[model samples]
Target: MMLSVIIKRTFVPGGFPIKYIDEIFKAIDLLNVDSKYVPREGQENLMLDIGEAMQGEAVLMAEAGVGIGKSFAYLIPGLIRSKRLKKPLIVSSSSIQLTEQLVGDIEAVSQILSTNFTYVVGKGRTNYLCYARYKSGNKHKDLTDILTLQEEWKTGFIKPMEKKKWCVDNCLFNQCEYRNSCDFYNMRQNLKPRYTSSVDCIIVNHNLLVEDLKKKVKLHQPGLIQEGHSIVLDEAHKFEDIVRDAFNIKINIKMVKRMERAIKDLEFDLGLNLKTMRLLTEFLEDFNRELIKIYAIEGKYILGNRLDIKELMSMKFKDMNLLLAKFNTMKSELRYLDFKDSKEKVYDELDEMIGTIIDYFESIGPEVSVYWAIYEKIFDVNGLALCSAPKEINKIIYELLFENQKSIILTSATLGGNVPINSAINQNRAYYEYQTQALGLPESTIYSTPQKSPYNYEENTLVYLPSMDIDVREDSMSNDIANEIIQLANIMDGRTLILFTSKKQMESVYGGMLLRKDTFTWKLLKQEDNGSVNRLREEFSSQKAVLLSTGAFWEGINIKGPELSCLIVVKLPYPVPDPVIKYKASTNPLVHEAEMMIKLKQGTGRLIRSEMDLGIIAILDHRIKAKKYILQSLPFRNVTEEISVVKGFVENKMAQYLSEQR
Candidate 1:
């Protein structure tokens, strides 16, 4: 097959002493060929090249444009390397949803492709259900809280899918009776665990990868990664900023309230007597007081009185250590009525409860440093936790690649520009190093990355920039933007998708448009009340809806087919001074600016997922003309080209492009 020829040449290049091109081809041909499951030529070629590149211990950045089957492009190489090299493949993505999707997709595709590869998925230690907490109900109040939460989850009010990854520290993974039946553990076993099961290619997020890297360095142990494995970062661009956030620390009052409420609920559920209830209430008050004191010492941005927030937090945590000892001692000394096993169950549960609280304190104590700061709105005197990450992601790449000598590949749809941690791939390396030393690296090195798109970008895409000079006096800029969308929508009819920077703006535009009231019929969908992006995309594809959304809508959304032929950008999606951004900006300007850049790129990447998937993208912001930075390489060249396509669509030349397609 054409694929075998390419794969053979890749592994056994000319002039190599160990060339095995002929033998390799024959061996691979022994595998049954399922014509229907064979990848397209473009995908096969790219996968073969990526596999060859990794075999040399070279890190490759494959920029597979949206929907070019990127997951498979990398998966084939990862699976092949895992089996051939006898190492585990760790695939990390930017989101939990993608992590779950990767696991499922890999399993589903493997069956069809006849690749008998085993796989496993793991999250942070907190994700599992704590057996000790489950049985003891006395110690960890959070278990009761989660049960209450599960009730709400069943009603579809809150999704616990993401939260299921972090349970508590008291969980004993090896001893759990459910280990064999657990969904996560079962998935791990399915990966075909061999005698050397120490976590081969672990699927992790940028946040977790960065966290582990920090831990590895702090612990001064490179041996932590000695397990036979390589790393594959799926959405690599996010590596930079995620490392930054993962290193810094912050705590919110909402979490404290959640803890307090859970404690009270546990008290009631356990049916404690008035005396015991009083003692528990007093204990919570003490816990609250101690938490505040700790926050004062740790959460502050600056240190004062010779004790920085970190030191103060450390002292406070030590005090908490003492308090837990005293609390346990008192519980043993005071005798209460021993009733039926149910009452005894509640009493024993409290012991487990103390263990849970102690676990949180211990986990935070070593991994996070305490800081003292004022948290607006939530707490007047909030103590925070913080951790400073390594200066560069190269430290991580170094451990994953050089120290481990395992194959690593980084791929993303938008890796070239400043991309958000949640959506696009970000560069974690410092700018000065990138500017000075990056140029010297090999084309296969960290500096010189590869572009893996399926189409000629300049020819296939044109960026359209509409005039942003709106009269500030007229409350009609939104109206005008809506009108423009309507005009473009008519041009493409049912095949247009309009993305708003804000839901309020989306509402305003949709409300202002009058054409859709008559024979100008088209499906109009807006992201109302926090709907899942996957569900929205499903609806958009099935019913060609003009989907309107706020923040999450712009990135991580995929829509194709005749339903979404055009995308309208209402404005340059500069983030508002939202609480979280504002909070971070108040303390660190550079980090905030980096975050804004990342967000902007993510917003623009919503259109033109693949080479064959064509669409007109219009940016209704005059900022392109006024601000020179908007024209810079920040948003990728596709943004510039897509603007031209939007202009062409409105100018009646869309017909010409259609004829070309025909």
Candidate 2:
């Protein structure tokens, strides 16, 4: 099975051996500054292991403690490898914060190594500014504000992509009339598509990297990763989600609505009696219910009746595409006349909807993939859409990403160890390894290590469980969790991070705490109330704020100060039986349980970010005890059931934190 995938899979033999020990030690020493920088032996060893692993062309599956400097550890190796080989190293992170952190770290490490590494920040189709759309100016107030504001710059660089309706596939590039003056045109040439550049390092979020991976695999497009380049996935714990997202082809509700509006115009002009469009719309609406069923269990390999498209085409109506095609042709003609201004809304709607409908047809044909469609009628999200993915994600990653690559580094603070915790916990770890096993390189081709955090957890942190042993399933459980949080907030008195599994639960407790009026003298910021996660993180870091957020906020927002002295766990972070988890869990409950523990560890990893910072982890839910294997997931050295004394412990820490300030 030869793939046209490789433009450059050939590695330079004996280009550079892993003999950079002195250089590594010296770089670590230089980075280990007295000004808020403490060098740890764990970090140094990890960096050495990573450098050797890259030199050996091995997959280094490593887990480091919270303060092990994992970013610098892997990054130093990657930068050195790229510099040594004269080839770029691709680094992918899961979160924006981590990406930003890596960029900053690269700057600092560049000083240590005294090597100028040219790295490209890969922002896929969404992030780039589109010059065609800006000129179209389809009644958007922001577009107007951008045009007026952008006149001051050499190019209207500030007027980037449309945040709501970004269509990267349809970009005209050099073909547009304003191509010379276009922001996107200049950016595409100057900023991005740097595979041909001498600089071999590129940094991207998991989503962008996965998208590029898909482009190479499915479309055979030579994207960011080229010949002889290696990839290091930092925050590698989020690989499963990346795997899911890479193959996820979603047909959104907005696309359907646009198609509907376009159909109305097509009927007005051509009068084709778009009964097929209405039927397609109904199919989308019903598709939502069908998706929920599949998501709750295992994914649907084939869904919504075997004869779905067959029955639809036989309904004495034209095909859906034919109707949309006619509308687009009529739109072009309307532009020639004066009616384009009057029908600009319809014209733009037709363009957006046409692209979306085509995307749906291409993805949801149900001939080659497994898929599900989701629908939500809410204030923020309203519409129905279908999502599709290939059946084997691990296999694809292994063959495409690892098999031909020289070296791959997978590092994260919370990548659960391969060591079996218990029978049940081991099952989840096995499942995790199984999903990642698709990389399929020889055992000798990869390296694996688990580096413990150097922080003094026993002295700096307490894992406090409720003394009352309240059941998580009870109807009054919300009140119990909220009550504990309110008291803990007042006692901690500086800042707190409360992790929740769901927004509904967070809302219920958030509203309940506000009703108490004396929950604390400090302010409570809900994730929903904050316009952005970055804003929420910034506010929480600045004030005595209790930040409430869910899954996405689990790992990245690192608040490492005495002010962040307490972490409250509202519930055991379990895998909600979403289709992927449900199917995997059906075969092995241990895998599901292990997944929960990994998430729990990620939340707890937030506390005691440094040895000097002391804090307490209060688990409101008693489920952690019920599942004895769950204890294996917890990173805390001292677990206490006595919730009464936790108040005193946190109070004394808070006093000390405040006194140090005085």
Candidate 3:
């Protein structure tokens, strides 16, 4: 069958590739799992629609509710296509934590389908040990951390250091002389061999993928290896921020000091001779002197306002270019110095140290904007150079994804508001107003696209809000909201998820709530308990008690059965004031205004993870009442049962809502 041809036949209801489907059903059949695999009514058609998207070259913007299995909806088809077309499927997630979960799920599904596929995680170059650096550690100063970690691994004081500890500049690939028996390098090398085998699916985070697209554009080109290739972007809502960060450049004083310190360490501490040592020292001294001079002239002023680093640097354009040329020359020269068995070892260290500075200087030009920062005594060094990639993030997305005609599946629990995809574009400016002005990107020029969520909200789940007047925001003068919660606890009993917008509110309510002591025991759990989400969910289910937490508790939590019959959203989570938000809000009026809506939706989404999961959402914010703006954007405004509170019978109203629940 041609990859472009869509099949007319509707597949069976049972999933084809995923093994967890059986386990999912088994849990439901045995009543071990609280939620069932119920896609919202007719939205099952979305699965078919997505199947068509995977079969051809098209972009899908699916906006479904929290309960619908959006990940499975896409993965099952991707796996089947991989088998039929003999192509490699690569899936990228938004975060490391989410990446881990999807990897596990893919493994389970692959086993169940009886398919032979190899999975390899693609990370940046920095994640492996630099065999080149190990050959000549005598050239660099900070071998303390690396040497101690290696010693720990040898004595089993510490396990093998994960990829998180390594960087591309420091990584020594298979060429490392110690590849035969080195623990750290050997383990990583063995993790993913070259894709000579049928490695059908590759998984990555959106940030990593987008970063690769911007930083390593040639590496991500489709059909490079002739394996049937496709990209699945999970949690697609976060693509904008990832794109933004990937395109933008941040050069702060902190980086300069680290390089300066490394150079100083190589010279004074390591007591080693480097071919580029004199050149680097001379350059550093020159750069340091120039920075001190600039700082002295513009000490009291802010970074960009007083001295535009780009503008000042450009004034000496020819000299700077010559300096960079010489730095590169010195870099190439270091590679040829022969010091014997380990004489060439300093080449990697010297190359890395010099390259760090060269990268910073070369990155600054007409296409780059530079900023200067003044740090206190942390370093005797004056203001440091900060340079950023001049291109807008949307431009990078257009160049890499849209311009390439690659099919993209963008899915997120929170992508767009009532406004279409067009509105979401550059809406981040409202949150990043100041930075935009500081970096100088036009606020009006960016484009925002809107599409519905891919999850099925109606059949999969309904948004529930228990009507109440007790606002958690009220302190001494108003009645404590806990009084109302204590009453609701009595009716629904202990199986409730009490979600709070802040820890301050949760503690207050928990303190005021009435406990049954024996018949209905209540246990309070906060998000800061140093427990994993799964562990907390397990605790909530086993104890059949109320689990109270702030923001993280709202979304990314799945619970069903008698253990969690109620979800209490004590308050609407709104974005608090911060430097980033403040900066953006100063530049964009629309985004600045709608910050509350974005945060509220993200917070409310915590409950009703699936169709079988039922719960109550009680918003304690008075802003929703006075503004009327917040009310219109709330999910399921019509179906959510509302109760007006007038007198002070918080308990009676709570009793009525709890009694109505199944």
Candidate 3, TM-score vs. the true structure?
0.59
Q: What is the lDDT of residue 386 in candidate 1?
A: 25
Residue-level lDDT tens digits of model 2 in 1-662 = 11221222232234464365446656766777635568777787677777767766677777778888888888887887787777778889876567777788888778777878777665555554455665475545555654554442222122221343433445666567767865556545643454435774777878778777777877798777776777888877777667766666665656555566665654444344255455555655554554444344433312222212323233423444564564455445544544335566666666555554555455444445445444333211244445666545656777667766667888777666442434452343342453344334345444445677888887777888877877765546777777888877787774789998876678777778878866468878887522455556777887787877776577766777766778888888877665555445655445565677678888888877777788888888887776665665455767887765777666665566644521
C-alpha-based local distance difference test score of model 2: 0.64
Give the alpha-carbon lDDT of every model. Answer: 0.51, 0.64, 0.50
lDDT (tens digit, per residue) of candidate 1 on 418-527: 32224232243332123112112223343223334454445554566654454322346767776667766766665566666555566767787754456357777776
Off by over 4 Å in 3: 1-43, 95-118, 121-170, 175-197, 218-228, 244-261, 264-391, 420-521, 529-551, 568-571, 576-599, 626-662
For model 3, residues 447-479, the per-residue Cα lDDT tens digits are 112223433344333343445555556655123
- Give per-residue lDDT, candidate 1, residue 95: 68
User: What's the distance in Å from true for residue 584, model 2?
Assistant: 2.7
Descending-lDDT candidate ranking: 2, 1, 3
Please list the residue runs of candidate 2 whose C-alpha ends up more than 4 Å from where it truly belongs after superposition: 1-15, 29-36, 128-144, 147-170, 175-187, 190-196, 257-275, 286-370, 379-382, 417-445, 586-590, 659-662
TM-score of 1: 0.60
